[model samples]
Each structure stands twice: as C-alpha cells, then as structure tokens.
Target: MHIKTKFFGDIELSTEQLWHFPKGIPGFESERKFALLPIEENLMFQVLQSTNDSDIALIVANPYTLVEDYSFDIDDPTIELLDIKQEDDIFVLGVLSLKDPLETSTINLQAPIVFHTSKKVAKQMIINDNKFAVRHIIGSQPSLTKEEA
Candidate 1:
C-alpha cells in the first residue's frame, strides 16, 4: 500500500510492515495502524509512522541501546492486550525527542512502545516505576563506581 509519511514522504509498504495498535499510542488513541520505517543508515532509530496520518510520526529506538541497565516487566494488562507469550515475541522501543545538537536529545524511557512481532500488535506502555525519567538524555551514560569501571 502507498502511504505518505511526515519524514519519508510517499512510499510503498507491504502488509507485513504494518502494525495494529488496538489501544493506540497515548494521546493518539484514534490512530490505530502504524508502520515502522527505518531511518536511512541508522539502525538505532526508526520512525513509527501512522499509516492513516502523514503527520503522526514518532522517532523511536531501542531503550537498551541508550540505557544498558534499562529493565522492566511487562505488566499483566499489557501482556494480555498484546497477547504476548514470551520474551522473543516482543521488542521495546522508546519515543525520542530530537534536539538541535542531537546530543541534547532525549528518549521517553518511562513509556516504552512494545511490539509483538508475530502478532503485529503494539502498545505504548507507561511504566509505574520511577526508576526511569520521562526525558532521559540520549548522550548521557550511566555513572559507574571506580570498582565497577
């Protein structure tokens, strides 16, 4: 199917490239379908483009790459919503807030977008824990003690 995107402009996509968000992402509940489009030459980031709306696109990346210690449990409600069965069935991506210098950019670690690979379903889940910040600087690295380093 051919669809227009905010960053990528008009492009053709296969059915397998589409993802169905039953509950949709926060604030955009009505926008259900999305396509994960890759940023040219960048494996760390991807654009979560709403198939229905050209303006509704989010830059997302694997939170683990930015925060090595990032960890969270998939709440029971989300598991059931996405029908997730095992760890391999799903992968998580955090929405990125691009900044002018790029190094000043931040990622929304508090709410990670979880995708079920086989099911083609996804949801942006808000973590109940306060361990992660809403806007974690992408360039910031976790400080390690001298012993650990």
Candidate 2:
C-alpha cells in the first residue's frame, strides 16, 4: 500500500512490513500500526513510521549496538501482551533523538520497542530500572559490526 511518511515521503509498504501494537505506544495510544522502514545505506538505524499518521515517525536502532551490556527483563504484563514465547522470538530497539551534531544524538534506553518477529507484534516497553537512562549518548560507546548490529 502507498502511504505518506514524515521522513520518507510517499512509499510503498508491503503487508509484511506492518506491525500491530494492540495497546498502542505510550504517547501514541491511538496510533497502533507502524511500518519499520530502513534508512538507505544505514544499517544501524530504522524509521518506525506510523501507518495511520503521516507525521509520526521515530528513528530507532538496536540498543545492543551501542550498549552491548544492556539487559532488562520484560514484565509479566508485556510478555502476555506481545505473546512472547521464547527469548529468540523478540528483538529490542531504542528510539533515537537526532541532534544538530550527529555525534551528540542520544537514544532512549529506558524504553525499548520489542518486536516479535514471527507474530509481527510490537510494544514500546518502559523499563523500571534506574540503570537505564532515557537519554544515552550514542557515539560515546564502541560500534558493532554488521553481524552484531
């Protein structure tokens, strides 16, 4: 289907690209559907574009790329919401806040969007851990190889 996006403009998205967020995201409680669009030539980041709203798109990346040691447990409610069965079933991604200088960009580590690949279901889960911050500098950490990313 052809849909207009905030960053990518008009584009064609296959049904497989669509993800269903049953309860919607925190701020976007009504925007439940999203399309994960990858940025050209950039393997580290992707645009989580809201299918229902043209103006809603968030830059996301695998937090593991920057914080290799990052770890968090999914609460019982989220586990049931996403219907996650196993550890390998879900992948986590962090929403990024782009800055004037690219190096100063920060990622929201406290809340990571977890995607259940097989089910095409996703949820933005906010971790209650104090160790994880809402804004974490990106370039301060070591980079990961494509395989790792």
Candidate 3:
C-alpha cells in the first residue's frame, strides 16, 4: 500500500509493516494505524507515519540512545493489551519534538511508545515517575556524540 506521509511523502508499505495502535497515541485516538519508516541518511531517527492521515507523522527514536539511563516499566494493562510475552519481545521509543536549532530539540521521555515486536502492536505508555520530563532536553543528555546526531 502507498501512503502519503508528511515527511517522507508517498511511500510503499505492506500490511506486515503496519503497526496496530489499538488505543492510539494520546491526542491521536482516531489514528490507530502507523508505520515506522526509517529516515534515510539518518539511522538514529525513524518516522512514525500515520497511514490514516498524512499530517500525523512523528519523529521517534529509541530513548535509550539519547538517555542511556532511561528506564520505565510497562504496566500490566499494556503488557496484556500488547500481548508482550517476554522481555525481548518488547521495544520502546520516544517521540522527538524538533526545534529550529537541532540542539534545542526535546524528546518526550515521560511517555514512551512500547511495542510488541512479534505481535506488531503498540501503545504510548505514560510513565508516572517524576524523574522523567515530557520535554527532556536531548542535546544536554549524556552519551549523544557529534557523530551520532
């Protein structure tokens, strides 16, 4: 299937590539289906493009890459919903909030998108811990090197 995306423009996707967000991301409850498209020339980021709407794309990355100490627990509800069977079955990603200057960009560490790799199901799970911020500054975080960005 061909989808018209906001960042990547039109691209081909298969049913297997479609991720089913049963509850959808917050503020986008109606947009359930999404595809994680790789951003060419940049391995650190990926585009979470909505198959339903072209304007609903989000730039996402593995929070662990930016914040090495980043850690969160998946609630039982989300585990059951996504049918997460084992530790290796699940992977997490954080949405990136881009700014005019790339260094000022932030990532929403408070809510990480959890995915069940085998099931292809995902949900944006909000962490209740006060240690994380919704707009965690990416540039100031540890482990991000000049080459990585």
Error of 3 at 26 (Å): 0.6
> Which regions of candidate 2 fall more than 4 Å away from where they truly are?
140-149
TM-score of 2: 0.92
Per-candidate TM equals 0.92, 0.92, 0.91
Q: How would you order the candidates by lDDT, starting with the best?
A: 1, 2, 3
Clashes of each: 0, 0, 0
Backbone clashes, candidate 2: 0
Give the 10-residue window scoring lowest on summed lDDT in candidate 2. 140-149
Worst 10 residues of 3 by lDDT: 140-149
By TM-score, how accurate is candidate 3?
Answer: 0.91
Candidate 3: stretches off by over 4 Å = 140-149
**Model number with the top lDDT:** 1
Candidate 1 achieves a global lDDT of: 0.91
Per residue, candidate 2 scores C-alpha lDDT tens digits across 81-140 of 989999999999999998967778999999999999999999999898999789988876
Tens-digit lDDT string for candidate 1 (53-122): 9999999999998987899999999999999989999999999999977778999999999999999999
Scanning candidate 1 in windows of ten residues, the lowest lDDT window is 140-149
